[model samples]
Target: MVDTALFTIRDERLSLILTRRKDPPFEGLLALPGGFVHAQEDADAEAAVRRVIRGKIGFDAPYLEQLYTFSGAARDPRGWSVSVVYYALVPWPLLEKNTSVELCPADELPALPFDHHQIVAKAVERLRGKATYSSLPAFLLPGEFTMNDLHRIYQQTIGARLDKASFRHKILEQDIIEEIPSRFRTGAHRPAQLYRLSSKTLTAFERKI
Candidate 1:
């Protein structure tokens, strides 16, 4: 089986997408989006996961990475099974209108079946660890956003407050985002310049924030 732990920042909270199973052995229970790998169609585990996400979520995830493999006889109810897990990040707006799935807080998920909870925990740990020195958290934001928006996302995903000035300088120095020739006005403050990622790829830094 191929499973995905899809994450997003919704209402300033880091949340994950889960769907209810319609069939057994865990019928009517919430679980990560997953399906059995198609032996003839899927070229690789990654491609299998991509097909699963598109079929379930109605869109392709902007950021997807192989997380870990979990295998054991006790993990599944039907004999022994191995699950190749992947973690994905998408902007909230892409999933806000999708009623087929549930968005739950990543840190407070309920007891899940088939070792899914353990998989989610591992994925969260990986995301938080990567956010400290890479542009991984930015995938949670929309295509066009302000520097402040990016800063808040990093803080939320990393689960800590950051020095605003330091973060700004460090991110700017990385040169990963470019000005969008637009501005966003928040209440009485001056319009903040809008920016977009320079490349649709992850950026790793030499030092942690």
Candidate 2:
């Protein structure tokens, strides 16, 4: 199985977590965090994903899902190999402060090796769809955040403008989050309510959608 991490824009710049190949084939090229499945290992895809993320990126991912499998005969340069891709959601602030592999932003990324570019593009498309139909974007949010913060994440992930009133209505109607009684006073405007994601509510919301 192949494990991939989808890193989003952090501080106004798009970025993804990748690793430099240490061997032949795609040596020296940056690619998503993943590796081939080893025999006698757990057959669970999620387990394989966690192992790859921790081994390659040096961090444990909290959210992951099976993406797709690429089995084209000529896809792999090492004779023939099938890849079972898995997608991981990572928040910007959760990244490690120091990394050896060049963590270039999306716009400045150099040419990638193999079919990695195609894999990244497909993972992004899947994220956009999940953002619209599920509470997946919540994975990108910090433990606590404001309504505005959530709105901004949604806009960035889905690449669309959302009406303030409509967005608020839908979120509240879904009841997937709880507004913390404490208000954060950041600016001169009225204090906005802080919210915490509710596990029960999130499960219900996904089911409803």
Query: In lDDT terms, which candidate is top?
Result: 1
User: Pick by TM-score: which candidate is best?
Assistant: 1
Against the true structure, candidate 1 reaches a TM-score of: 0.97
RMSD values for the candidates in order, in angstroms, are 1.1, 2.9
- Per-residue alpha-carbon lDDT of model 2 for 72-189, expressed as tens digits? 7577687676777887766777675645545666556677776777887887787777778667777777777888888788877776778877787888887778877765746789
Residue 178, candidate 2: C-alpha displacement in angstroms: 0.9
Which portions of model 1 show Cα errors greater than 4 Å? 183-187
Give Cα distance to truth, residue 200, candidate 1, Å: 0.7
Instruction: Please list all clashing residue pairs in model 2, or write none if there are none.
Output: none
Error of 1 at 25 (Å): 1.0
Question: CA lDDT of each candidate?
Answer: 0.93, 0.72
Error of 2 at 127 (Å): 1.1
